[model samples]
Target chain A: MLDLFIDLSLFTMLVATGFAIVKMRRLFGVTMMTGVFSLLSAMLLVTLDAVDVAFTEAAVGAGISTVLMLSTLTLTSRIEKSPVHTPWIPLLVVAVTGAVIIYGTLDMPNFGDANAPAQVGVAAQYMERGPEDMDLPNTVTYILASYRGYDTMGETSVVFTAGVGVLMLISGLRRRRRRKPSRDEGEVS
Target chain B: MPEIEYILGHLNYWLFTVLMMTGLYIVVAKGNLIKKIVGLNLFQSAVFMFYISLGKITGGTAPIFPLDMRIDPATVYTNPLPHVLILTGIVVGIATTSLGLALIVRIREEYNTIEEDEILGIEKELVAQENRTLGDAMGGRA
Candidate 1:
């Protein structure tokens, strides 16, 4: 019952924060709300027993991303210009997509069902043998660093590529300027 | 009683749906490019929530083992796979955000404006100029 209460309240705050983000016109306010939203979701993840994800969300979403966004804001305008186009079409599109997703969820397994397909597959095997095989206190760390190391490597490369791309895009090397001999000589002419 | 149970059991999914839709709305409706990127981040995080929720067991503790390395057969542990995957996802999300912000910086430099509509308008004017020059050469107005 307490879990449910925590879940619902956190979700309420999340939705409220989302609505606030959508309504705000000031880019700074929206950026701050985005950080708040990430932090709230981090709390929700903790309730769902995903401490690793919660940690990452708090670090990356609320910490680093917020700083990056604020710096981006410095390069751009602070307040969003009033939109000339009506938002009806986008609303319709989002509503239809949301309805489809909700309908799809009808056939999904009940939350926390032990017999759910997701809980029974490879996850079960991992739960059964991961600790014994790896002898690690944190199964998440073992799996991330040992069992699924290849995928993590790929993810690292992707991050590196993204960083290199950002550097190339924003800050290419400055070209050396050529100067006339007279200017270099400082009034010798 | 069954209906009430169903609703309670599936409440998490419903919340995920609402968040996903809200993020989608922001991405599609917002004109500011930065706002759109923020919305994309939100949408991706909602997906992370869905995956994490699916991994939760009713009575499970976290997936961490005890410090002494003793294994307890009766103690349930939530799935750690999703958490691992989401760590990679979180890193990727930050990478994408930084890359996108870099692109926005370039766009601002080129166009002197970050608003999507104004950028499109400027491009349209450039296209019209090209068409007029080509049309004169072809002995017809564009």
Candidate 2:
């Protein structure tokens, strides 16, 4: 009973936060609300017994992303320009897509049903064999680091690529500034 | 009634749908580029919720084995695959966010505006100028 209450309350908060994110015009408010939204969803993940996901959500969703957005805001404008066009078309598109997704969900197994396909498939074998293979108490760590090591390596490379891309985009300003003096000397020559 | 039971039993999914649609609306309806990125983040996080909730078992605890590292055959463990998968997703989401913000920085530098409509207008103006110049070079109307 209490669990149900917690779920409903978190869901309510999540919906409220999402609406708030849409309505806010100040880009700063929207950014902060996005962080709050991540934190709220992290709480919901906790109730759904996804502590690891909750942790990652809180850290990445709320923590690093918020900081990055704030710094980005430093480079860009803090106030959003009010949209000139009517939003009805986007609203209609969203409504149609959402209705179709809900219709698809009608066939999904109930929340937390033990016999759900996702819980039974290769997941069953992972839980059964992970301990013996990796000897780790936390199955998530074992699966992420050992069983799916190659995938995690790929994810790391993606992070590296993104880092390099960011540097390529924004990190040239200081270097360019330093080279300006040399360019002036060449021009004078 | 079974209908009511069905709706109530899948409360998680209903809420997930609502959140997903809300995020989608923000992405589509909002004109500001940063706001669109925020919407994209919301959409991805909503998907993370859906997958994590699906992996949960009603009575199962977290997937950490007992301190002694002994496996009990009957002990129920919530699926950890989704959790592992979501970790990768969360990291990728950050990478995408940062890269997007960096690109937004470049967009602002070039266009001096972050509004999508305004950016489109600037690009259109540039294209028209290029077309006019090319027309003059081709002995057509300047």
> In terms of DockQ, which candidate is strongest?
2
- Runs in model 2 lying further than 4 Å from the true structure: A175-189
Error of 2 at A132 (Å): 1.4
What are the per-model DockQ values? 0.81, 0.86
Worst 10 residues of 1 chain A by lDDT: A173-182
- What is the CA-based DockQ of model 2? 0.86
Q: Which consecutive 10 residues in model 2 chain B have the weakest lDDT in total?
A: B3-12
lDDT of 1 by residue, B1-142 (tens): 9898899888899899999999999899988899899889889989999989999989999999899988788998898888999999899989999999999988986787888999999999999999999999999886
Q: What C-alpha RMSD separates each model from the true structure?
A: 4.6, 2.9
lDDT of residue A93 for candidate 2: 98
Task: Give each candidate's fraction of reference contacts reproduced.
Answer: 0.84, 0.91
Docking class of predicted structure 2:
high
- Report the lDDT tens digits of candidate 2 across residue range A2-48: 98899999989989999998999998999899999999999988887
Tens digits of per-residue lDDT for model 1, A74-149: 9778888888889999999999999999999998888988788888888778867786788889988988998899
Every candidate's lDDT: 0.89, 0.91
Model 2, C-alpha of A107: deviation from truth (Å)? 1.0
Per-residue error at B94 for model 1, in Å? 1.1
